[model samples]
Target: MAVRRIGLTGGIGSGKSTVAGLLVAQGAVLVDTDAIARSIALPGGIAMPALEAAFGPGVIDPAGGLDRAAMRQIVFADAGAKARLESILHPLIGAETQRQAAAAGEDAVVVFDVPLLVESGRWRAIVDRVLVVDATEETQLKRVIARSGWAPEAVKAVIAQQAPRRARRAAADAVIYNESLTLEELAQQVRGFWERWAKSSTR
Candidate 1:
């Protein structure tokens, strides 16, 4: 039996997490790549040794974990550094993601909450569908600032670095316009989506 996988993605502050949670409530299994990445970067975690060697001691914190903030600054400024870093982490993350998805079992509707799904073109082929949570760049900036306390310019920079809105939309099999939705409204939309797919997957 094959698990039906949905690749869910959105820009920062676009409420993708909320949608993921709602789908989980509807009995969907979630394979969160970000959480897996964080876990692998923890002290003595699987990716730490390779990270330390590739990026050097300076990239590791005193606690022995990868210093994500410092590494972010390094990679974003240098494409080669970013590529090198991804080479060390991506394979590890992909393996863990696959293991988790497999453990979710055959009947599960697995939702892969991938923040960079659009940028990672490979994900599009692996999942049965792409569900994008969308909002205007202005909406994204304001929401991120309000929630994360990030500077408006910093939020804009992240948005700029992501695959553009048009590209994400083009890749989407379904879209959740989250710019003005209340939590209840957002959950309703997610629930409807899950119902439709869950019903169809059985047939």
Candidate 2:
């Protein structure tokens, strides 16, 4: 039996991470793309030097590390800059994700937590299912602002760069509405979905 590959995605602050954590607790081997991206741009990671070369010195902190926040600000404001950054990082992230997925054997139901699954387009063919955790844009804005202390405009800018909510929801094989659920409730939902998903995959 091959492991079932699940692409899990959502808009900013849609509680996707909370749900991913629950799935992890339930024995799903989680591969977080954001974490992978960050790691790749960290000091010794594969993509760091290329990133520094592409964006120049200011993009690197005094410690000679990628300043993620500064990069985020630049990419969020400039499409070309964002594309350049993704070109450097995405392939490295994808390679690592594929390597991890291959190492997790048949029983592992691996969840690839990607924030821009739809926008990337490359992941669609590789994944068995795309699970979208959804919330209204207003909810997303409020939650992001509250959690990250980002200004409203900044939060909105990030949101603008993502695929629209409707498009993401339409792409999903499963949808988890996360607007008003408690952590416990969200966990229960993930468990329930896994029960059904696991059984179906085995058949």
Q: Which candidate is the best by TM-score?
A: 1
* Tens digits of lDDT, candidate 2, 1-203: 24388899999999999989988887788999999888887777788789888998888877777997899888877889988997898889989988888888766788999999999888889888889999999999999999989999988888988999999998998899999988888888888888877545644
- For candidate 2, the TM-score is 0.93
Clashing residue pairs in candidate 1, if any? none
Backbone collision tally, model 1 = 0
Per lDDT, the best of the predicted structures is 1
What overall lDDT goes with each candidate model?
Answer: 0.88, 0.87
Q: Which stretches of candidate 2 lie over 4 Å from their true place?
A: 1-3, 199-203
Displacement of residue 115 (Cα, Å) in model 2 is 0.6
TM-scores, all models, native as reference: 0.94, 0.93
